[model samples]
Target: MSTLYTETHIGSMQLKNRFIRSATWENMATEDGHMTEKLYAIYKELAQGEVGLIITGYANIVAEEKPNAGMMGMYDDSFIEEYKQLTELVHRNGAQIAMQLAYGGTKTTYNVGERVIFAPSEVCERGTKTLGKAMTIAEIDYIVQAFAKASLRAKQSGFDGVEIHGAHSYLINQFLSPYYNQRDDQYGGSLENRLRFLVEIYTETRKLVGDDYPILVKLTACDFFEGGLTFAETRVICKKLAAIGVDAIIISGNIHGKANDMIGESFEGHTIQPQGYFHQYGDVISREVNIPVITVGGLTDIDAIETIAANTNIQYFALSRPLLSEPDLVKRWQNGDRAQALCETCSKCRTKRGNFCIVNKQRKATIAGF
Candidate 1:
């Protein structure tokens, strides 16, 4: 029997099982960053589907720098009530939920020309091909406080935890990347300097949320390209986070600036991404740190998950695309079917209306004679 169905703890939070619903960009929120009913429906399904933990899509921390359209916002107190409803809904269904907070920085062009966007340095963002204004020390201080206040809001709104989005080539990841952070100041020269921004954010966030609340960080194990954040530097960052009292760490990363390449199998059917691509990093970091470690990177297959759990110190496995295709995947496994997930990892689930399984949709349509 697999041990994945057993209970686990991340700090004080007791989860029902080892399955975590990794955060994905739903693009289902309102333009102003409020959680919409669509998002609520999505979370509700996952909660009821028996996911032990759910990390909501990255909520934009600053109002002026929402890097993507339809992102949830946590810039002020206004977000509390709606989120309270969300947390209560998840809790009612017997699952724990955490809010993932982020600042998109130069990774997007959502409002690039109209407003000022922050970056570690004035490097051109490869994804959007846009430039950002290098932030001053005062601006950096403002953002640190923004993260702290957002954490407070998350706690007050009844979330079980908060995960800082320190990966995905976002603002924090940019600071940690030498390719992006060319600044010679205190925030940028060596690995220690590059780590300063994330450390400060964690310090301020911890102060507000208190020591008991679970504060997790999702970090890029490597930037997977030349001159970017390397795995060697990532190890040091994970160790520092553990020493400084982070409750848990989730290991993730980007490959050549393509998010899909990190997880999805080649759609052209020529190249295939190995399952659990990030597991090696998680295994190394988990052994090196004393805290809980969660790994996310196209993880599927019950047997493989069971094997990983049996052999490694990695405490949790997170899934995104598979869960999109089968929200009740955990329940399905629990019931003893134990087959691999139905998701093909084709990356077609992503759409403007929020991610839904295109394969499932087509199957249902065909069955209904549509």
Candidate 2:
């Protein structure tokens, strides 16, 4: 009987509605990873627009793990006050926010200056040709501790929770995928070994944050590639995470390299297709886990949202491009406009300048009679 606008709780964090703003890479922070006024304004706007929950852009857990310029950082203690200010602003505007802690692994570029890239095993990553060195046992232990410390910082900063980014073929996802994780050590080989990294991370984080503080995870339901993490494997992973008291699971998939399968591309004959491109995988995973499952990717239509809420036990709907196009999308739907989002999903927001949606800007200008 729950609806999109109904209030819900992900562990102890109570949200006003079921709509969540998925974690996106907003290239808006300083090179050293300080929060900026422009970044603060984006979350304030989303808060004022009435989105239920907002997960911030990926915040690197360590300096060497950063994926791009302007990616936010939690690697240092200095960044805590800035994030506290951000959380205060968003909370004052009546929205809940979570910081997504991540490590880029081999998916990063060296333009940020040369740093050794760490991976499950030393392997040549596709497209980049850069050979990632296998992470030593000490390095692996360090990364795990880093995740726990970052989660502690998120709590100290007054964020409602922290999301461990284990999706999109990042360092955590790389560990989960057999295609990338070929190590025979305790951190690889068997599925349990591969998942040990995440399990240790969650365990350590929970120990620091305690039982009441929410600790959610953004996980890939599938890598959608041959020899990659599959839906079946994902189910087992989800169950284990649930058993360890993961507050919720935000179901997502793949990395940017597999854009077609990861984000779903527009075809020649279709201007509009089904909403919630990853719902099928999410549905399967949702049934496997007892925790709330939030599904993201290609969820643009209001009708589709209502139908999914009515038919499935899925607890939350997360929108990325749609919120970029209309930050007040949930408000508009509640007001009964019920129109599908205008985002073409061209993903121009993924540009180097920042995560600004040019199509949304143009639409706004048009509405203003420009």
Best candidate per TM-score, number?
1
Tens digit per residue, CA lDDT, model 2, 49-168: 799999999999987667788989999789889999999999999999999999888776656347777888876565465567799999989999999999999999999999999987
TM-score for each candidate, following the candidate numbering? 0.93, 0.93
Number of the top-ranking candidate, with lDDT as the measure: 1
Per-residue error at 265 for model 1, in Å? Answer: 13
List, residue by residue over 94-133, the lDDT tens digit for candidate 1. 9999999998888886877888889999998766788888
Off by over 4 Å in 1: 256-273, 362-370
Clashing pairs in 1: none
lDDT of each: 0.87, 0.83
Which stretches in model 2 have alpha-carbon errors above 4 Å? 110-113, 255-273, 362-370
> What is the RMSD of candidate 2?
3.9
